[model samples]
Target: MTASLELPDRLAAYLQRSGVALAVSVCEGDAPLMFVNDAFTKLTGYTEDEVKGRNCRFLQGEGTSEEQRQPLHDFVHGLGEDSGRFPILNYRKDGSEFLNYVFMSRIRDSSDAVRYIIASQFDMTNAMQRSKIRQNDETLRTVLSDVEQMGREYGLAMMSSAQQLADSVAMMARLSLRDTR
Candidate 1:
């Protein structure tokens, strides 16, 4: 795809001001670099002229797995005709791999044909690692709490109706006592 129209000043300014990096491509058989912001240039270590008219696949390396490539292929080939997410693990020109969550969309004209593809990328490697650690901690805490609750109610009939379960643990203890009596 080729963009016959120019990027609006407002949208261009917005992309520039946005802290995160972004790159836009116009799919011409293969995805071609149309525009990239300064942040994107800084992140990828590629100059604007060096990337213009080049395919973004240059970022892929041996470390890049098929799991990442397949989804990207599906998005660009199928949903790229519409608008889809192109999240993938991509490498920078510097050979540094990063988790890039990219959302790809098409720019249309009066004829409703794809004119351009705008891909916004978010570097999520750090945030995703942090989230995994937090999730593990949360899971451990939940498991420990469940274990403790089981210890306190050992060999007891913990199962109950929804109304009974909604009651406090103290009320449940009273019910248990009455049952034993």
Candidate 2:
């Protein structure tokens, strides 16, 4: 993307201050990064100076699944018109892992030729982990309920057995008393 086709001053300032991470790359070969907002730098742990000429794929690491990469590849190749959104395993500069929700779209010139690719990345690691924790909590609750039910059943069975034993003792006492009389 040409630096001349700049975002409006007000809008650029707004994006730079946005809480969401945003990045822009040229649409040409390799799609080298052209701009990255402060949030992007914070999220990826890379300054714009370090990433300006590199493709964003540097964020991907060994844990990044191939399934997630395919859709991104297709989107960048113009195979799909809709913006692509996918969760990818990404590693920060410190080798820490995070779940990144990547959303990518193409920007076009007035003549409809693609000019740039703008991508936004949102960290969803906490949200995903919370969801898993909720599921585990539900499972634990179900297991506890089952255990409680079993305990109740066992208690009832024990009570019934004790009552039967008491009745038998009473019958034997009456029989002995009759025999003595």
Candidate 3:
């Protein structure tokens, strides 16, 4: 990425103030990082000065499998146009793990050539946890249904026996009354 190519001042200012974690990489060479927003620093703990001219792969670690990163690699190398979305397990500068949902899109020049790739990353840890919680909730519902069914069966058996006993007592009382008469 050459420092000579710069974003328009108005667009740059807007991106700098945006709340989204944004990164722009040049399509040339290894797709080096050319720009990053403040939100990107907040998410990855890296300043623009430290990441400039470097590939954004620094945030990836052991948690990011080769299969998950291959699409990104292909996109960076201009080998794939369909590589747009990625769910990556990335590491922060403090060594903590975060699930990042990244959306990458290309910027083309007037000649229809690729110029830059803009990526927006969102933290997906909470969404993943919510999905697990929904699964657990479904399991709990199944268990509660089983417990209720068992209780109903037991209660019905007890009620049937009690009714039978009452009928027997009524029959014996009538027999004794008839004999006395």
lDDT of each prediction vs. the true structure? 0.58, 0.64, 0.64
Q: Put down candidate 2 lDDT per residue, 1-181, tens digits, no spaces.
A: 4554454453346447645577877778988887788989998898889999788889999999999888888877788863567689999988999898776767655455665677767677776577865753464354334334433543432122212222222222222223333
* Structural similarity to truth (TM-score) of each candidate: 0.62, 0.67, 0.67
Off by over 4 Å in 1: 1-5, 78-81, 129-181
As a whole number from 0 to 100, the lDDT of residue 153 in candidate 3 is 44
* Ranked by lDDT, top first: 3, 2, 1
List, residue by residue over 1-181, the lDDT tens digit for candidate 1: 3234445554456455544455666656687787778877887788988987887788778877888788677765646345555557778888899877665555544444555566656566775487865753464354334434543564444333212221222222233323333
Write the residue-wise lDDT of candidate 3 on 17-74 in tens digits: 6565778777777788988999999989988999989998999998899988998887
**Model 2 spans with C-alpha error above 4 angstroms:** 1-8, 129-181
Number of the predicted model whose TM-score against the real structure is largest = 3
Candidate 3, superposed: residue stretches over 4 Å from native:
1-4, 129-181
True-structure lDDT of candidate 3 = 0.64
